[model samples]
Target chain A: MTEPAAPIVILDKSQMAENIGAVARVMANFGLSELRLVSPRDGWPQERAWATASGADWVLDGVRVFGSVAEAVADLQTVFATTARSRETRQPVRTPREAARILYDDRASGLGVGLLFGGERAGLETSDIALTQGIVTIPIDPRHQSLNLAQAVAINAYEWRTLILDAPPPRFREAEPPAPGQLLLGMYEHLEAELDAGGFFHPPEKRPSMVQNLRVMLGRAGFTEQEVATFRGVITALSKGRGRVLAKLAAAKRQD
Target chain B: MTEPAAPIVILDKSQMAENIGAVARVMANFGLSELRLVSPRDGWPQERAWATASGADWVLDGVRVFGSVAEAVADLQTVFATTARSRETRQPVRTPREAARILYDDRASGLGVGLLFGGERAGLETSDIALTQGIVTIPIDPRHQSLNLAQAVAINAYEWRTLILDAPPPRFREAEPPAPGQLLLGMYEHLEAELDAGGFFHPPEKRPSMVQNLRVMLGRAGFTEQEVATFRGVITALSKGRGRVLAKLAAAKRQD
Candidate 1:
C-alpha cells in the first residue's frame, strides 16, 4: 500500500497552530494520513492550522479529537509514547528506527499502531507516559534536550516511511544483478591462465592458494559485465607486452 | 568522538529569520553544528533568529554566512540538494535515508559533507540544483506538494542522526537474548516425548517430519525462557492426565 493508515499520530496539548500545521504537512510527506489531537492549545479546527498547512488539507479534513491520550489511542494495538526526556516509568524504550520496525511489522499483519507525541513545553508527563506500553526516544543532545513539536513528529514519521518503503530502486537504475557468479568465474579462470604463463604465480607450492585468493578478492568487487571485460583486456595487453619484451631481448643479443 | 561533524547545512536565500532559527534548533538536536547562510533576504544575525532558536545559540554563534551556495559548499566533498519538485537537471535522486547512510559513513570516516536546502517558496532554482551532483527528494504526496523550510530540514536532520547513532540499549533493559538454541532443542525433545506417549503421532506415517515441522514453527516465535518453561509445563500436564485416565479404567475393571 502506498499509504499506511495505522500510525495514528496523537499530539497531546500542542501549543501552536503553526506546529499542528507543520505536523500535518510532514505527515502527508511521509504518507501518514491519520491525525488525532488530544486537547490542542488553540482548540479544534483552528483556521491558522489550515492556513499554515500550506496545502495539506487531506490531513486536516481527517482530524479526530479526543479528551485524553488513553481515549486517543484506545483502539491501537501497539502504542509508542514519543518523548526526548527520561521517564520515571519502566516501559521499554526504543529509538525511532526500532519502534518504526515493530510498528511496520505489526501494521503489515492487520494491526493498527499509534505514536504519541508530547507538546512544546517539557514533553509528556509521567501520567501521560503511563498510558502507553513503550517509549520512543530521539537521543538528542543531553545539554539542550528539547525538540520543537513538529520536529519530534517529523523524525518518527520519516523513520516509519523509510522502513516500510524498504530499499527503493535507485534513480540511476542502470544496475543489472552484477553479471552473475558464473561469468565472474570464467574471468577468474582466464586471468589465472595468463598469470601462470607470465610466472606471476610464483613459488609453485603457493600457486594454488594464491590463485584461489585472487579469485576470492575479485569476487568481492562484484564487478559488472563491463568491468570484467575491461579486466580481461588488461590481461591480454600485459601478455602481449611480455612477448614483445622477449623479441626485443633476442634481437639485441643478435646485434651484440 | 560522540558526535561526528561533517554535514554542514547550507540555507540558500532564506526569506525569514524564524525558519533559519528552527533549522538551527533541529540541527542542535541532531548533533550538527555547522550552518552556512547564503544571502538571506533579511540579512544575517537577526535577533528574531536568536529569539526563535530557544537555546541553539551555539549554531548561530558558529555560522558561516556567505554570498552564494557555491561559496558555502566549496570546501565540502559531498553536497546534496533537497527539493520536492522535479528538476530538468540529470542529477541522480536519493531518498533522505539513502543519502543519510552515505553521509554518515563518509563523515564517520572523516570526510566533510553538506546538505543544500532552498527557501520557503518554490525550492531550489534550476541553476542552484544544477550545481550539486545528486538530489534528495522528500517523496511527498503529489496531490498537495508543499513543505515548509524547517520541516524539510527536520526530516533530513533526523535521518542523518538515526543513521549515525548505533543501536542503543533499551530503556527498560529487561531483554536477555531470546533463550539459546540448545535450550530450545531440549524443550522440543521434551515436548516430542510427551506427544509420542500420548499417541499423537497419527497413523505412524508423518511422524518425523510432523514433529520437525512443529519445532520449526515454534522456533519462528523466538520464545524467551519463560515461554519455553510454560510450554514444557503444558506438555507435562497433558501426559499426567493420560496416565490418570488409564489408572481409572484398570480400577473399574477390577471392581467389575
Candidate 2:
C-alpha cells in the first residue's frame, strides 16, 4: 500500500514571519512539507521566516500563497480549523489527537486533508470556519489559554507525527471520501442563493450569521460527491415547487 | 475519588530565561503549576522571564530553585526525563502519551510525579537521566530533531491535560506507592558504596557510566519504601559476610 499523504498546513492572515518560520520548523519536524499562506500580513518571502525556520528550508521553500482561506483550502477534501475557544457554530469539535486520527484515515483513503490555523491575533473568522468539516481545539487549561501560534501548530504537527510513527488500528468503517472543499462550497452557495430569494433570512442584519450557521450545519455532514449533487438537486426541486405555487396563486387572483 | 495531583515540571540546568518563561506558560496552560529549576544559568527571577511569560505569573511566582536535579526531585516518587534522542541505558523509553498515562495513574495513586527536562544547550546529563525511572521521547521525525525546550514541555503538558480532561478507565492493577526519591537515593548510595569497595567497576574511568547504568536499571523497579528497606538490609548482610571471610583468611595466614 502507498503511504498516506501528509496533511497540508495552512496559516490564515499570520502577522509575524518569525512565527511562520517556527511553524515551518515544526512542520518539518513532523514530516509535513506542504504549507499554504492566506494573506500573510507581512506578505510572503520574508527573510525572517527563513532565519527562524532553523534550516527547515523545504517547507518554506515551497510555500503556497493564497488571497483568502477559501482559495487556500480549495482542493482539500477534509479540512479542520484550529480554534482556541468554542464558537457558536454547529460544527463538531475534536481534540488534536482525534483530528489527527481522522486526517490519517482520510489520507489513507486517498482523500486530501488539511489543517487551517487562524492568525496570531484573531482566530479563523466564523465565515472561514464554516467552510471546513470540523474544529480542532487543544484541550488546554481554562485559566491559561495563551498558546501562541507556533505552539498550536507544534502540538498538531506532533500529533500527526505520532500517528504516522505508530498508527492505531483503524477503528472507523471504510467510508466514501468527503467531497472536496470546492464542491461543498458550490453546494453551500447554491442553497444560500435559493434561501436568499425565498426570504428565509428574515432580518437583513441576521443574514450573515444565519448563512454561517446553515453552512456549518451542512458542513458537518461529511458529504460525498454524490451526496452533494443529491442535496443540491433536492434544493433545486424545493425551490421550483415554491415558484410553481406562487404562479398558480397569482393566476387564481387574476380570475377572481 | 479525589482529583489526581498535577505532575511537577523540573528543568535541569536550563540556560535561557525566555525558554523558562515559555515553559511556565505551557505548564499553566496544561493545569501544571509546580515549576522547579535546577541551577538555571542566569540565576532566578530574571525580568525577561516574566516579560515572556505572557501573564502566567502564578507559575513564575511559585518557582522553586534547586542546586541539582537530585535536589529538585527529592520528594517526588516518580520522575520521567524528556530526551530528544534515544540513549543506550536500560531505562524504558515511553512516548509522551504513554508517559502521561503512567504519570496520571501514579498521581491517582497519591504518588508525587514530575517531568524532568534538560537545558536548551544540552539535554539532561546522563547521570541526571539515571535519576528518572523512564525516558519520555516526543517521537518527532528523525530527519528533523530540533525540538526546542518549551515545545518539548508543551507536548508533554498537552498530553497531561488531555488525561485530566477526558480520563480513560484506569487499566492497571493498583500497586503500592513507590518510595520517594530520597529513600531511593539512599538505597542507591548504599549499593554503590558496596560495589565500589568490592571493585565491581572494572576500569576506574568507566565507573560513572557503570554507576549510571546500575541506577537506571534499579530505578525501573519502582521500589516501595518497604522494598527499599529490604534491599538495603540484604546489601548489609552480604557485605558483612564478606568482611567475616576476610577476617578468617587473615587469621589463618597469621597461624601459618
Candidate 3:
C-alpha cells in the first residue's frame, strides 16, 4: 500500500507570529511540513517566528501565504476545521481522532488533506468553515474552553502521527479520491448562479446563509471528480431546459 | 458505572512558572484539576504563573507542592510518567491513548491515577521514572522531538478527556485497585533492606541500578493491596529463616 500524505497545516488570520512558529514546530514534530498562512495578522517573515520554532526551520522556510481560505485549500481533496465550540452549520462535528482517521483514509486513497485552524481570537468565520467538509472539536472541559492555538494543532497532529505510527490495517473500503477543492468550489459557484437566476434563494437578506447551507450540504458529499462533472452537467441541462420551456411559453402567449 | 476520577498531573523539577501556569491551563481545559509540583525551580506562588494561567485560577489556586516525586504521588494507585525519549528502564512505554485507557480503567476500578511530567531541560530522572507503573510516550517525528512541556500535558490530558467523553463500556475485566504508592514504597524499602543485609546487590557500584531494576520490575506488577501484604510477609519469613540458619551454624561451630 502507498504511504499516506502528510496533512497540510493551514492557519487562517493567525494573530501572533510566535503561534505560527509554534505551530510550525509541532507540525515538524509530527512530520507535517506544509504550513500555509491565510492573511496572517502580522505580515509574514517575522524574526520572532524563527526563535520560537526551536530548530524546525524547514517548516518555517517552506511556509505558503494565501489570500483566502479558498485559495489555500484549492488543491486539497479534504479539509477539517478545528473549532473550540459547536457551530450552527450542518457539518458533522468530529473528535480529533475521528478526523485523523478520515484524513488518513482519504490520503491513502491518493487525495490531498489539510487541517484548517482559525485565528486565536474569533476562530474560523462560518464562511471559512463552510469550505471544509467537517468540524473537529476537541472534547475539552466545557468550563475552561481556553485552548492555546499551538496546543490545539499539537493534539490534532499527535493524533495523525499516532495513526501513522500504528499503521492499522485499513478497515475502510478503498474510495475514489474526492474532487479537489477548486473543482468543488467551481461546482458551488455554478449551482449557486443557476439557483440565483431561478429565484431559488428567496428573501435576498438570507442569500449568504442560504448559499452557505447549499455549499455545506454538497461539500460533505465527498464527490469524486466524475461526480462533480456529472453534477455540473445536470445543472446546465436543467438551466437549458428551463430556458427552452420559457421560450415556448412566450411564443404561445404571443400567438394567443 | 461511577464516573472515573480525573487523573492528577504531577510535574517534576519544572523550571519556569510560565510553563507551570500553561500546564495548569491545559489541565483545566481537559477537566483535570489536581496539580502537583515536585520541587519547582522557582518557589511556588509566583505572580507570573497566574499571569500565564489565563484565568485558570481554580487549578493554580489548588496547586500542591511536594519535595519529591514519591511524596507527590504517594496516595495514587497508578502512575504513568511522560517522557520524550525512550528510557533504559524496563517499564513498558505506551502511547498517550493507551496510557489514557489504562488510567481510565484503573480509575473505574476505584484506583486513584495520575500522570507525571518531567522538567523542561532534562526530563524525568531514571529514579523518578522507576517509581511509575509505565511510560507515556508521545510518538512524534524523531528528527524534531522538541515537544514543549505544556504541549505534552495537553496531548495526554486530551486523550484522557476524550476517553471520559466517549465513556465506552469497559472491555477488560474489573480488577482490584493496585496498592497505593506509599504501600508499594514501603514494600520496596523492606525488600531493599533485606537484600542489602544479604549482600544480594553485588559490586557495590551496581547497587543503585540493581535497586532500580528491582523497583521497576515490581512496580509494573500492578500488585493489589492484599498481594502487597502477602509479598511483604514472604520477605519477612525469608529474612527470619536466614537468620535462624545462621544462628544454628554458629551454635554448631561453637560445640565442635
Query: Comparing to the true complex, what docking class would candidate 2 get?
Result: incorrect
Which has the higher lDDT value, candidate number 1 or candidate number 2? 2
Query: Model 3 segments beyond 4 Å from truth?
Result: A1-256, B171-173, B248-256
Clashes per model (N, Cα, C within 3 A): 0, 0, 0
User: How would you encode candidate 3's per-residue C-alpha lDDT over A1-256 as one tens digit per residue?
Assistant: 6557789999999999999989999988898889999999989988899999989999999999999999999999889999965557656678999999989877776678999999999999998888987899999999999899999999999999999999976544243466888998999898777776666666899889877866765575566686678556545543553455445545555655
Q: What are the models' TM-scores?
A: 0.35, 0.49, 0.50
DockQ of each: 0.01, 0.01, 0.01
Candidate 2: global Cα-lDDT? Answer: 0.81
**Model 3 lDDT per residue over B1-256, tens place:** 6667789999999999999999999999999999999999999888899999988999999999999999998999889999965557656678999899988877776678899999999899998888888889899899999899999999999999999899986544233556888898998888788777665667899888867866775575566676677556545544553455455545555655
Put down candidate 1 lDDT per residue, B49-100, tens digits, no spaces: 9888879999988988988765676565457899865444334567998788
* Position A136, candidate 2: lDDT: 96
**Candidate number 1, chain A TM-score:** 0.62
Best by DockQ: 1
Q: Candidate 2 chain A — worst ten consecutive residues by lDDT sum? A: A167-176
Winner on DockQ between 1 and 3 is 1
Q: What's the lDDT for all of these models? A: 0.69, 0.81, 0.82
Q: For all the candidates, what are their Cα RMSDs to the real structure? A: 28.5, 29.0, 28.9
